[model samples]
Target: MFNINYKSQHPIYEQIIDQTVLFLMEGVLQGGDKLPSVRELATSLGVNPNTVQKAYGELERRGYTENIVGKGTFISSSHQVEKDLAHQFKESLKEIFYEMSRVGFNSDYIQQIVISVLKEEEYVTDTKS
Candidate 1:
């Protein structure tokens, strides 16, 4: 369900975390679905089982998943994924805005850019329909 890029600056476990989140956000992995075994996933991905275990541990800590002994890891349904996605988006936006400011972009220009993108997204959605 995920492809690892060895050349990427990010760690393998981090990539797993990212892809798992994306899968949940995309509805490719539903709540209550059991994730593959660590050994299984590690063998498939050609990474150490420790890596998958670490990723699973982090996911559980972050409330993205729950581990059931003797059963396995499953996606958590306690939290609304859409709400979580919005929160993540907001955090990412803040980081991007900070970087933009560091690069000399003014708040007004950033606001304009964001507004323009929203408009373009709306136009694209309209065209698709």
Candidate 2:
């Protein structure tokens, strides 16, 4: 369902996750769709099956997918996907914020860093709110 670049600094599993998420957001892969099995995808991409498995595991963990025993993985239904992902991103941010906090960065520092990063993006404007 996605292409892989072996030479990219990003990890293979993460690349898979990113491409899959992009596909979902871009309407290239629809909800309720079945993704290739781990073996099929790994063989096609010429990567270790564990890599594909890791990607799929992350996708499942992130609320983008659900795996049914004996049936493989499927994207969440369109109706429920938005709601599921809404909280998921917040949960991810919480984890990141917690990690950054442990390193002595408080919420204000984190907000400034986020705003700075947003300001650096050409398409972003007025990130302060």
Per-candidate Cα lDDT values, in order, are 0.90, 0.87
Kindly give the stretch of ten consecutive residues in candidate 1 with the minimal lDDT sum: 120-129
TM-score of 2: 0.63
Least accurate 10 contiguous residues by lDDT in model 2: 78-87
Candidate 1 residue-wise lDDT, 10-129, digit = tens? 999999999999998788998899999999999999999999999999999988899999999999987666678889889999999999999999998998888778778885343211
Separately for all candidates shown, the number of backbone clashes (residues 3 or more apart, or on different chains) is 0, 0
In terms of TM-score, which candidate is strongest? Answer: 1
lDDT value for model 1:
0.90
Query: Which candidate comes out best when scored by lDDT?
Result: 1
lDDT tens per residue, model 2, 33-107: 999999999999999999999999998887788999999999877555677556667888899999999999988
Model 2 spans with C-alpha error above 4 angstroms: 78-80, 83-129
After TM-score superposition, the amount by which residue 25's alpha carbon in candidate 2 deviates from its true location, in angstroms, is 0.8
